[model samples]
Target: MSEGAFKKYGKRTLVYLFLILMSIISVFPLYWCFISSCNNTQQILGGRMVPSTHLIENLKNLFAQQDVLNAFKNSVINTVLVLVLSLAICSIAGYGFEIFHDKGKDAVMAVIMMSMMVPFVAILVPLFQMFTKMGFVNKYIGYILPSLSTPFLIMLFRNNARTFPKEVLEAARVDGLSEFGIFVRMFVPMMRPTFAAAATITFMNTWNAYLWPKVVLQTPDSITMPMLVANLLSGYVVDYGVVMAGVTICTLPTVIVFFILQKSFTEAVAGAVK
Candidate 1:
């Protein structure tokens, strides 16, 4: 073979080898968790990696808890609500900031971005006090409100929106559509990939939210899935098998959503603004 051809083959081979190694590293934890979830705490403590005969028993114990299924449902509801509300708010904010342009909006966006640097824990005390005064303690709304439009997501949408074609928007206005109509009818359809990307991220963030939910939700009836998983180990003797099963179950929805939006994610994240 020619030297150039051999060099090309060697580079491609190295890239593939690196990718395979990274894939294994990323997936090994989930694989181990699945294996561990199928065994009892004693077997897990013994460092077993292979699947055992206790899978059904582990699942039974996880679901037999009264709060498990309810928390799962609450998680679904909160995730869906956050997904819908966050997409609407962030998409509009992004489009307006990028397409419309204003000094005041720019200043406001800067402030919002700066706020992200402050740790959520720093604001938890004030937020809890405000929620208590407003009677949002132990409420689903409390779980869904704090993250309605995250700064990182807003910036993501804005950057993506900047790539949107200006000519089409002007043409829509020439056709006598109002500003809101132009946004809803013209911009939204063209930004389907962006919306899909936003929905996937917002849903995952909401589904996996734990610290805030645990802090504000004082009652079992309103607790979320992550909170429930955490509560599993509150007793003197922790059950590793049940906790791993709960973790596996908690991981499925995010995985499913990512798979469903995989193509959209790639397409939306690609390209840059002119």
Candidate 2:
């Protein structure tokens, strides 16, 4: 090879090596958590990063706790509900903003964007008071209702919809399709990738949600995974093994969902760019 070509190849090889190292470093924590979850209390305390023979024991202990199962079920339900509701609502709103633009709609979009800038913590007190007054505390509706209209998700959908071909919608219109019909039949199928990306993100957010669930869900049965995990850690003597198990349980669903939808997630971003 020529000297210039050799030098360019060498630079690219070095960059690839650096990226591989960075990726390993980023994933090491998750690997360690998995290992720790399989370890016994003694192994964990000894700082062992390898799997121990205590995996069965840890599983037994986790399942022995009655509340753990209930918490797991509640978390699953909440996560699924939130994912479905948020995705549907956000996608529809996003499509509307992009496909049916008007002066009023533009103004509404601006307001939604501005709402995203408001710190969630800033509204917590008022939201709590409102929920309390409305008798929504300790209810599933309290948990789900507040998150149904996420501004960030709406923005994500709207931004993605910008890349959708206007001609496609026009053709649907020419074919005597109503706006809702076009959205349901044509737009949704075409936007699968974007929807997958949005679903993965929203599902993760809802699954890992802690503060809101903790505040709103007063009853043990209604508490989501993160809230349950927090409560487990709140005990005076924290059981690291049990806590790690809880963390794994709480994380597995989102991880599985992400892996399942990863192709769509990438395609969605690619479609948006196109």
Candidate 3:
């Protein structure tokens, strides 16, 4: 090979090596979590990465606590409800903003984007008071309602909707199809990739939600997985094995969902970017 070609190949090889190293570093924590979950109490406390014989014991302990199952169920319901409602509302609003243009609507979209700039912590006190006034504290609705209209999801949908062919929309209009009919029949099917991406992200966020749920949900029965994990970690003795087992259980659903939707999710993002 020529010297210049050899030099370029060498630089590419170095870049590949650097990326591989970074990937390993990024994935190490998850690997450790899994290993620690399967380890014995001694191994976990000792900070060893290898698995131990206490896997069965940890699993048994995790299942023996009845509250864990209840918490899991509550979390699943809350996550699913939040994902469904949030996606539906955000997607529709996004599509509307994109397809039905008006100066007033543009101002409204600007306001929605500005709302994303406000930190949740800044609004928590007011939100808590409002929920309390409405007697929504400790209710599933309290957890799901505030999140049902995410600005990010709306933005995502809007961007994806831009990819929809204007010709198709115009043709539908010529066919005497109403705006709503065009959106439902043509735009919705074309945006499956975007929906899949949105679903994956929204589901994971809702599933792993900690702060809001912790504040709103007062009872054990109403608590979600992250809240339960926080409570587990806060116990006086802090049994690492038990905590690992709970973490494993709590992480499984999101991981499974990601694996299932990963292809479509990637395609969705790519399509949106295009």
Q: Whose lDDT is greatest here?
A: 3
Could you tell which candidate, 1 or 3, scores higher by lDDT? 3
Instruction: lDDT winner between 2 and 3, please give it.
Output: 3
Scored against the true structure, residue 260 in model 2 reaches a CA lDDT of 88
Which residues of candidate 2, in runs, are more than 4 Å off?
1-20, 263-274
Ranking by lDDT: 3, 1, 2
Number of backbone-clashing residue pairs for each candidate, in the order shown: 0, 0, 0
**Cα lDDT tens digits for candidate 2, 118-234:** 988899999999999999998878888888898777877888888789899899999999999999999899988788787777777788888888888998788887887777667
lDDT of 3 by residue, 105-146 (tens): 899999999999999999999999999999999998999999
- After superposition of all CA atoms, the RMSD between model 2 and the true structure is 2.9
> TM-score for every candidate vs. truth?
0.88, 0.87, 0.90
Candidate 1 lDDT, tens digit per residue, 1-274? 6999999999999999999999999989988888888999999899898999888998898888646788888988888888888888888988888888789889988898898899999999999999999988888788888998788777878888777888998898899999999889988998887787777666777888889998888898898888888888887978899989988888877778778888765544452221
How far in Å is the alpha carbon of 76 misplaced in model 1?
0.5
Clashing pairs in 3: none
Quantify all predictions' global Cα lDDT against the true fold: 0.84, 0.82, 0.85
In model 3, state the lDDT of residue 4. Answer: 94
